[model samples]
Target: MRHTFAELFAPAIVLVFSSGCTVGPKYQRASVPTPANWETPQPWRPSDPKDTVPKGEWWKAFHEDQLEALEAKALDANQTLKAAVARYAQARALTSQAISALHPQMNVAPLAQRQRLSGNRPTSGVPITLRPVTQNSFTLPFTVSYEVDLFGGRRRNIEASEASLQAGAADLENVRLVITAEMASDYFTLRQLDSELAILDRTVATLDKGLQLVTARHEGGIASGLDVAQEETLLRTTQTQATLLHQQRDQFEHAIAVLAGQPVPGFHVTTQELSGEPPALDAGLPSDLLERRPDVAEAERQMAAANAQIGVARSAYFPSLNLFGNGGWLSGDVTKLLNVSSAVWAVGATAAEAIFTGGARRAQVKFAQAGYDAAVANYHETALNAFREVEDDLTGLSILNDAKTTQQQAVAAARRAVDIASDRYTGGLVSYLDVVSAQQTLLSNEQQLAAIQGERLVTSVLLIKALGGGWDASSLATARIKPTIKQALQP
Candidate 1:
């Protein structure tokens, strides 16, 4: 029988067009329980639904220029973040590789060789005389093969890869969010140390003057040696406190340096006390905002990929279709290669069905289903945690804000008591012990205020992180800056 190339391929071409379908189940986001009746505390203002999470340059909301600069450095140079980006690139490459399965693969080989027939070799017991013959062989050949996606197994693989790539992207964004929040927390903590150090220094200076006063009064016979000794001891204790604060501040400074990807030893932050209250944040209901978290988005994408894998597993039960073709020119004379008489060609199509596998294919289907169920559970767990975090931060900020107000009043009353006690002591109306107690109370109150203020700032950063720092899943698929692999280098 004689057949034209088109006629030989006609059946397969028909299958490719007429029988293509995806057997895999369509992806649906699993239902998760969202926290209902979420309330925004009085001091925290509610925002537009669209502004659920903190948005781009969210750190700028704190109005700390140094923090903004440090964030930029981390984004550009942090080793952990760079590693995540490299992983995303690798995932993207895998996706492209999977998509390549849908199209034909072709390769060509050019050959030049010399061959000889041995005279000593038996020639089927022929009586004719044997002779040595040598010749040059030149050939050019091309081979091509393609698997038809008649059952869409290849397409299912592609779907899984693409979903995994999106998940990789979301993971990168989650890493970014964590790093930025950590840096913010560390920087504010350093500033908090600065404020405490300043408070301790003031206490030390005031105690030094009190020591001088008590010593002079003792020499003038109006005070006893005991008062002078007690005053000196108090001054030394306050000095010790200031020294300890210095050590703590240096440690926090080192942390900030590391966050900025700089050497710890030489890096220095000028002494600047933490100032002002936690900046105002856009607050809202949890249901409207939970999806903004990258971790949540990553989990959802994981489920999607697993769903596609189920389709891939089921697809293995259907028959596979493939087409193969090869053509070449061959001749002993190099100049005669590619001539019509030297041409050779072949074409074929195959449909293969796996009749048995000892239940391996069925097991794969069950395994894929289990994976999807696990992914759904993880997604729900993540969502629940997100809600919990928001509630904790909101309540924490509200209580702490109120506490700071009461603490400021206590500091003021303590300062007044110290002034009154000093006056009474100078008039010899009371023991020096009274003045010492009042001074200690005043210093303690001031230090407590600084500590509380620092906590407020740190808590604010955590709250912003909980709200997704203005990042959302909408941009998870677009990806950051990347160089494209051109067509020839890619699929």
Candidate 2:
């Protein structure tokens, strides 16, 4: 018995030490090319190199206290984000479970039974006899089973699970970034509507006063009925515009309510004009984008997981070793079950080799390798897309900046023209039609300016989002809510 135990334990120790070799190809991160400088022309480069937007708080740059509060509320209450968090936790638990395969499994069994043996036997050289024997038996057994990871199959599985968990965490961060960006965009849009509505209200009031003056002049026989009719037409048009603005504002208000995770009827945001300058974004070099972007990180993690899966698949070509042992006592009587004299022990080793698989094993290995290749390609593509988004936002910001400047000048000129046309018509130097045309031009330019302002703000938020919401390695480690393996394993 002692010799048997020694032999079994020896192979287990050897197997433990030899489980270090991981089969299949080692994973090397695919290199991504970085551009030296932004392609877009800039009026000013990053002004403060040291003053960067911190990870997880990029939205604070807008300097809107209300926006910050709404973002916080969404992060806490949004159902989609909560589901992502739960999925991350599940991945973490799966990682832990995969790792546990490297350890031994143990179980205990205790049994008691009473049996009666009836003897009516005709022995080879003896006469038949009838008798009954009663006996009580008790047995306590225990087992220890350990799978010897001879080819590192279990280890590779654990590695894959760990990488998957990391990907899940990155995905959760991505969800948060998306949610925050959406909230900011919606909030800014609602504010833009408020500004437009305010403009329409004032325009309507001004047109009404102008119509009253024109009517008084017609009553005094100084102005023709044509002038009164033109004035009335302008007033009605401005009122119609105000009605349209009100409808737009109401739709945006309802959207904001949904984004804030509130019932539409219970949620309300007061009409407030958009007043702040667009927050400036400091997009670092392209290489920085790869490290800072959560989606890119997620893709890299997926590649790593695929690489590990290849190892797991290749391990199937080798033999598997397992060690099983049990030691306990058995006695005919319950009173003597724990006695040393009733001791018993057993230990064994099992080795299995897949001699034939009809090509299934080879196919699996090829499949795993193919998956790894696909993952690498996907990761590279994701990185490229991230760069494209940053470049596009940068170009958009530069072009929109120039457009805003031109539009501002145009608005000023139109405003001045409206004043000149109004004065000319009152002095009988120009027709009422000229005044109407000037007012329409000014109103159109002002509306375009409002839209441009909203675009600038929305683009700024999008740029921040593309930059991965300021996420970094440090933020991953410091997130307030972290996924736990134990929490994931719960039923």
Q: Itemize residue pairs with steric clashes in candidate 2.
A: none
Across 102-172, the per-residue lDDT of candidate 2 in tens digits comes to: 66777788989898877754467876676877878899998888888877888788878877888888899
Please, what is the whole-model Cα lDDT of each candidate in the order they appear? 0.84, 0.82
Task: Kindly list the per-residue Cα lDDT of model 1 for residues 76-120, writing each as its tens digit.
Answer: 877788999999999988887787776578888999999898988
Error of 2 at 369 (Å): 1.9
Q: Candidate 1, clashing residue pairs? A: 54-469, 54-470, 55-470
Which stretch of 10 consecutive residues in model 2 shows the poorest summed lDDT? Answer: 474-483
**lDDT winner among the candidates?**
1
Which parts of model 2 have CA positions greater than 4 angstroms off? 1-19, 43-46, 114-137, 474-491
Question: How high a TM-score does candidate 2 get?
Answer: 0.89
Best by TM-score: 1
Number of clashes in every candidate structure? 3, 0
